[model samples]
Target: MASTDTNDIYWRAYFKAIKLQAGGGATEPGMGKEYFYIASNANRSIAASRFIPMATTNEYLYQEADNLMDPNAPLYVPGAGNTSYVQALYTYLRHVKRPRDTLTPEEEKAEKALTQKLKDAQATYRSERKSAMADWKEEKDFENLSFGAWAFKNARTFYAAWEALNTADGALQDFLASVYGADAQKYRSDMKKISGVANDILAPVPGLSMTCSNIPVLDVAEGIEKAKKGDRGPPVGEPVGYERPAYSLDPQYRDTMDRWAVEYDSTPSTGNAKVTWEQGSKTSWKEFGFENIEAGGGVTLFGFLRIGGHGGSHTEYENVKIDEKNSTVDIELKWKKLQFFNVYPGTWNIPQIRETYPEVVDLDEAQKLLIRPTQFLCASGLSITCKLGGQAKEEADRLYKKQVEAGGSAGVRWGLFGFDAGGGYKKEDGTQTSTSSYDTQKGELTISPTPTFGNCTLLGVRGQAVSI
Candidate 1:
């Protein structure tokens, strides 16, 4: 008859072989046993029944799908094929029960509309978050710079220049009123009308003409006209020529001031500085701080300093120098760390054994022989389970054909099965031998084996370490 008795025996054997390989009965080191079982179940279900309906197989596929979808899993693969197995199985089951090839027109339109709405919402959220973060960063940067000492000094200097200009202009107006009367008033009004343009022109002090000449304005204008006309003339001597006058401020003051301002502006406003020192039976860099050092005379030193806070915090050594010419402090710095953490990759391997019936005397002989040789078990348990599945299918097909010829209404169902009553083998001691019991109604397969240690070979392992 087309009974599942032989199928049950094969499944029992498959479970036993898997358990043995996975260190279930042997105290040998192995790959992760649970992971191996899961992988094996996935492989078996796909290979044997093409993921046919079985509570156990369904659960295994579901778990496998989740694992593949997880970003952290080593075996995870990106794409629908790897992550949609469970959903596809569910859809297949649904179709089998209520078969339909396509959705109705209304359903199709609704699905499209929902998909578009979801896409639009996601896009809007991303765009708004990006813009908000950019604005927050800009505001934070402005606030930090505004609170810095260098920024304060620059602002004070700028306002001082404005005040000086206003005072000078007021004095000039009084002098013009005394000398030119109504004409002076007209000049003042014209200046006021062009004040905005004057302000823009005066913003950058570096671009202003600082050189003073004793030559008359009319003579300088005549010289420029002659040069533009390509006239080859003898050099104008003494009073007729222009020459730079010595200023009260030092010659290098302008350059030094410019450098100081640029450096201070670039300095980040938070973090701690990492200092490295050399110790040779003497004091180190970390022990000394800049306290009694002189401010000028071209003295410069290199030392670590912190700048900014949180996202603003910058850590690095700065080239600090006091500019005597400009009576200002100058620094050059960059943000980042000089040291970092290291990382490493590693791997381990376990040896496995797969013996078929043709290569062994019998199941008992094979079990006894397998225990004598290996160390860590191959936790996957797939090698034997796959073979058993093929053998079981062949046996079931043969039996089904025979039953059909005998006019029986029986049919084969590829699912969980139990051994027939009184059909198990016997040990040399006359005791009944079975791996475990199976219940078809509950769709459960249980295997309980005695744990024992065995002799096995070791596998090679390797790893690498990297410094970052």
Candidate 2:
């Protein structure tokens, strides 16, 4: 009994020592070290004792404790003292007094490595974040820029030049080049070259010149059509019509006229011709350019200038006063109309808006509105439409039932409270807002507004839940 008691006491002490150092446990400072004895033959003795009858439980416990104290002990701590842990420890140590309690060489090296790694990570994260933010801001700014009237006007001029000449050299191109630099210059030059205006492409404007020489045969045909129809000729008092042929012309006179016709029959070619304006007129739809106005080749001919206007009104006019007899047919050219759009405070359903104005509901807005959640608040002018289907329907039904119960509070004799999803106290807006209600059992505490013009107002009560 004495041996057993002594062995038990030693075993307890040995286990306690191991727990204090290896595991977290209570141990007095300075006193705990006295219990352990360093022995050179401790391992051999422990092995021999294990095989002998003297291998008591206390000895086993002591051996186990020694093994645990060894640095090679087989124990695991998850991600023990990694970079993050080291960094945290470093931060703590920064404020700690360290004259006599400074870190060892290994710890100091680990601290330096961890600090550098963290700095590198932070720098990389900041760089990436800044770049991403800059790119997003630029894209957003570009979109907003496109919304301006000046931007639209410039875009129209640029596109018109490209469309007419198959190149981009109009006011928009010049402005873009000045602002955006040489990269835009190539774009303008490329577009103009594509439009068959390789040299001196005329920018689309009132007085811009187009050498009519190599002009497409189609343009000549158009001119002949205009002449035959006498479209937009001078006033009736002004003499302008197809010349009358004299039936009794002598052979010599006819021969001379034939020579003159032959000389003028060929199409004029404008290669390096320096076309300059001779005269300008807005009302007459005629402008003269080139060297000589009286003789044809020296004059630049520009006809029918058109300008644009705005507002809810649009105008379409035709010049029917062709020559003296034949009237010209009216043609539709420039038209303008004022388009008004409503700005919804929320992402209004596109389909709903389309129900009101189908023309404005495009595919882009339709998809955005349909997918966005109702909880999100949006700016004015933003419209959204949720796709019609199961999830929305279920949510709508749930909300309607909740609102109905809420409004029924004043009317109910027992002052019954209601629960949503599970039935309990709730707010009206909690169930739903800015949405429509549908299919419900009639006369079952249905809450709806008194007046109707695609709108309604209803009052309801809230309830609390009690667990029994």
lDDT of 2 by residue, 155-234 (tens): 45433333433222243233323333334454344323321222122222212221111101112223223434545233
Query: How many times do residue backbones clash in model 1?
Result: 8
Model 1, 155-198: lDDT tens digits are 45443444444444444334333343334454444333222222
Residue 45, candidate 1: alpha-carbon lDDT? 16
Best by lDDT: 1
lDDT of each structure? 0.23, 0.22
In angstroms, how far off is 207's CA in candidate 1?
53
TM-scores of the candidates in the order shown: 0.14, 0.12
Backbone clash total, candidate 2:
20
Alpha-carbon RMSD to native, per candidate: 42.3, 45.9
TM-score of 1: 0.14
The backbone clash count of each candidate, in order, is 8, 20
Candidate 1 clash pair list: 269-308, 270-307, 270-308, 270-309, 270-313, 374-456, 375-456, 375-457
